[model samples]
Target: MASTDDNGVAGYDILRAPGASGGTFTQVGTSTTTSFSDTGLTPSTTYRYQVRARDAAGNTSPVSNTAELTTQPGPSSGTCTTVPTVQTQWGTGYVIQPLTITNTGTSTITGWTATFTLPAGHTLSGSWNGTATVSGQTVTIRNVSHNGTLAPGASTTSVGFQATRPNGNTALPSGYTCA
Candidate 1:
């Protein structure tokens, strides 16, 4: 079953064997919906299953009425679609800055990178989880290792260095944009 709220409502599991009462169940993974397939059951074996629903607030409803079926021995395969969305935040510091990257996508996101151009007379002091390169008067942050799978809607934050010269322009940094 699916929760469809995008707030970490994935799927539920059957907690008991056939005809068993007072079984416990749990939620697995983070998504709106989940499906289960009984592919390896012996052809003549009977199986019973139930479903339930959950929300981001950790609330669960009564278990679904049980259903029974026999599995047909065969090969089975299927796929689910997941996408990735991202959000960024620029911090409060004027020169020493922090950027928080959040993945709002339906799928995992990896190897993410962001670039910004420095204003005249401004230079980057240092960076984390990435490399900062400068050419002419522009600075580029590259090779960022967002090594973790931003699972559907996870987030990571990084910080970098910038220096303002005595005659630095008061205008904001260049080439920095957020969606």
Candidate 2:
């Protein structure tokens, strides 16, 4: 956002409109920088952005040129792995902590799921930032609305879960497959 007037631009208000021009405009964020990186966007989706410049005197300029962008699909050859670490533990209960899902390929990963095993004696009791479902020893964790998009070489730390550990086994989850 260039200086809209002689007073110089103080900040920027970014608005995004879904689909085409007729859609409703929603203010995305306010930033002092010239560029913004939006995450958690669905792959193969299109969005329209309109930028407005705000002066030091609190005056706003007319909407600038609209920029349209379409996100590319996830990598066909990309690799994603969920690495779990221990955060805390107690009697008959333990936490899987927050796991980092890293995208090792050259393309962005969208709408991801972290698959792992909970071991025989552990059962999921609570979870956050994702949804977890267990079938036998296999656990499938899906990303929430946010934190779903992982850029190339990007690592997102998410999916902390509390599970009942009845067998006193403190080992981390295994079979960490992410997609």
Candidate 3:
């Protein structure tokens, strides 16, 4: 497996078998701090691994002390769970309500779709990167793609939206909780 370290430098690989030759190796995934994935191997076969480190200056460090493990039978599957909480704030205006979504989950979030529905009597004046639809008294912003994966503890900010309501009333969206 190839991995990236905390500084975003990306030149690391793990040799899964020390004495075994010609084992196919490939990168699984990358993030700021870590990368991991299961590789295809013979069931019940013992494998050794050695991790090597690299720096931005093109300098490579010695491989880590070798470690050993045995591959289990068949392919393994795992689930990525959503973070329990997200941080949010209300901007000054409907058009300026900037929402920041964070991923506090144990696994990386490959993407996120956020939907915001404006309250009654409100219409969306402008929005960025989000599709806005007005139906009756509700204005819905849907499927705003953040474009990049949000790693654990990572946050991304959505573009602002302008909203107009009667009598200068601030229109807050219902069911606007983030997590």
Candidate 4:
């Protein structure tokens, strides 16, 4: 931001507003130079920015024209992976907890789905943190509203399920795939 002040500009107040249509402006930073770097911003979001100049006498100039930008999207589902770990087992049933879903991509992921195959004679009994559906021996789990949207290299352990298997059968689920 540049301003021509008869009293000589002392500094510039950097203001920021969120959204494409613009919102209330707030003082985000002060800069003696012409630029500022805004950090810790959410991925795939829109933000508006403006600047105001302050002179040595403490007089404030009008804000500059709004500048809008939208950040790039985060990692996609193609870079995600899922792993299901057996937590406990009894004679007739077992549990899989902390089914970790990790984003290994370079950006943020909007959502994720995991698919795996349960062995024969096994049935899913319950699940949490994700929606689970069984089609024959194949189980599909999708992230719920809150657990979706992962940043790069981030992981969520909230997905898991409980299942019943044949007595004395120690087989675990296989073919864990994420997208």
Two-way lDDT contest, 1 vs 3, winner:
3
Model 1 CA lDDT for position 111:
37
**Tens digit per residue, CA lDDT, model 4, 35-70:** 788998888999999999888877788898999999
- Each prediction's total of clashing residue pairs, residues at least 3 apart in sequence or on different chains, is 7, 0, 4, 4
lDDT per residue for candidate 2 within 99-152, as digits (tens), equals 887888788767678888887788888888998888998988888878877789
**Candidate 2's TM-score:** 0.55
Best by TM-score: 4
In candidate 3, the residue pairs with backbone N, CA or C atoms under 3 Å apart (3 or more residues apart, or in different chains) clash, namely 94-161, 95-161, 95-162, 95-163
lDDT tens digits by residue: candidate 1, 1-179:
34444565444544334333444433323335566654445654565666676766666657788777766543112112212122222332244445545555566554344555665655555566656677866655543555334565555555455444444345455555322
Model 4 scores a TM of: 0.57
Look at candidate 4 and tell me the lDDT of residue 20. 90
Q: Which residue ranges in model 4 land beyond 4 Å of their true spot?
A: 1-78
In order of appearance, the predictions have TM-scores of 0.39, 0.55, 0.40, 0.57
Best lDDT among the predictions, by candidate number? 4
Superposed by TM-score, candidate 1 places the C-alpha of residue 53 at a distance from the truth, in angstroms, of 68
Sort by lDDT, best first: 4, 2, 3, 1
lDDT agreement with native, every candidate: 0.49, 0.81, 0.53, 0.89
lDDT of 3 by residue, 1-179 (tens): 22344444556655565334456443333323556564566776776666666566555556678667776653212122222122232344444445555665667665554555667766667766556666775544443555336677776655456666666565565554332
Which residue pairs show backbone clashes in model 4?
A: 74-107, 74-108, 75-107, 75-108
Question: In candidate 1, which residue pairs get closer than 3 Å at backbone N, Cα or C atoms, i.e. clash?
Answer: 2-33, 3-32, 83-106, 83-107, 84-105, 85-104, 85-105
- Candidate 4 least-lDDT 10 residues: 1-10
